[model samples]
Target: MIVNRRGWMGLGAALGLPVLGSHAAAAAAPRQGQMVHHVFFWLKEPGRAGDREKLIAGLKTLRAIPEIRELRVGVPAPTEQRSVVDSSYHVSELMVFDTVADQARYQDHPVHKRFVETCGDLWARVVVYDSIDV
Candidate 1:
């Protein structure tokens, strides 16, 4: 159950999913001391396109926060159906920060605060996974 970075990358490859380094944003990938903030949002009205777009729009607004080095917004991929694949979330975002301190500042940034106030109700649940390089 304790998979390291390489293990996860291998699993993704085996599953025919896009591996980390293959992304167009690979140049912006987190370095050894950087941090990644990954977040998933499950909408209250799961399949509502209107709500989804509104939330995504709000998420885009957070890019104005200075501490974010790179930000990518996405929806679940149309990968093969498998128990390990979690496609329940309506939207997801992956943000890379130069450091943990930068990421922390992003949390309190006014743009982020405004995003929550504007789109918080769209999601019934939100989950986040913050990781640093091993």
Candidate 2:
């Protein structure tokens, strides 16, 4: 008997193989969470000099928010490798959340917004990356 595409798909499904565009596979896939990290460079201002206190205070305020699973702010340590000496950015901030929705909420949070509004002007460039853990 000749097996068509539909027959092959049904056989695969019966054998518990994932079928493309199937609701079962979609439902079985794991849900991923979000992690947001930023590297900031302050050109006009000194390294962690101007607005440092206020920026730390704002970061602390963000830490107090429940949506933030993890928050860290620091400067990169010098590495021995010559190629690793690119110190263009002075500071970095990393924040992780349980879900993308939590990150969105954190963005809208008063403390986070205040932090950006307060210290954003000091930075010449800010790079942000958001990813989900597998």
For candidate 2, report its TM-score.
0.64
- Give a tens-digit lDDT track for model 1, residues 26-78: 77555788898999999999777699999989999998999998999999999
RMSD (Cα, Å) for all candidates, in order, is 10.6, 11.2
Query: TM-scores of all models?
Result: 0.77, 0.64
Best of the candidates, lDDT: 1
Deviation in angstroms for 103 in model 1? 0.9
lDDT of 2 by residue, 67-122 (tens): 98788877667766577576666666787787888888887888778777877777
The 10 consecutive residues of candidate 1 with the worst lDDT sum are: 21-30
Clashes of each: 0, 0
Give the clashing pairs for model 2. none
Instruction: Give me the overall lDDT of model 2.
Output: 0.71
Backbone clash tally (model 1): 0
Which regions of candidate 2 deviate over 4 angstroms?
Answer: 1-34, 47-49
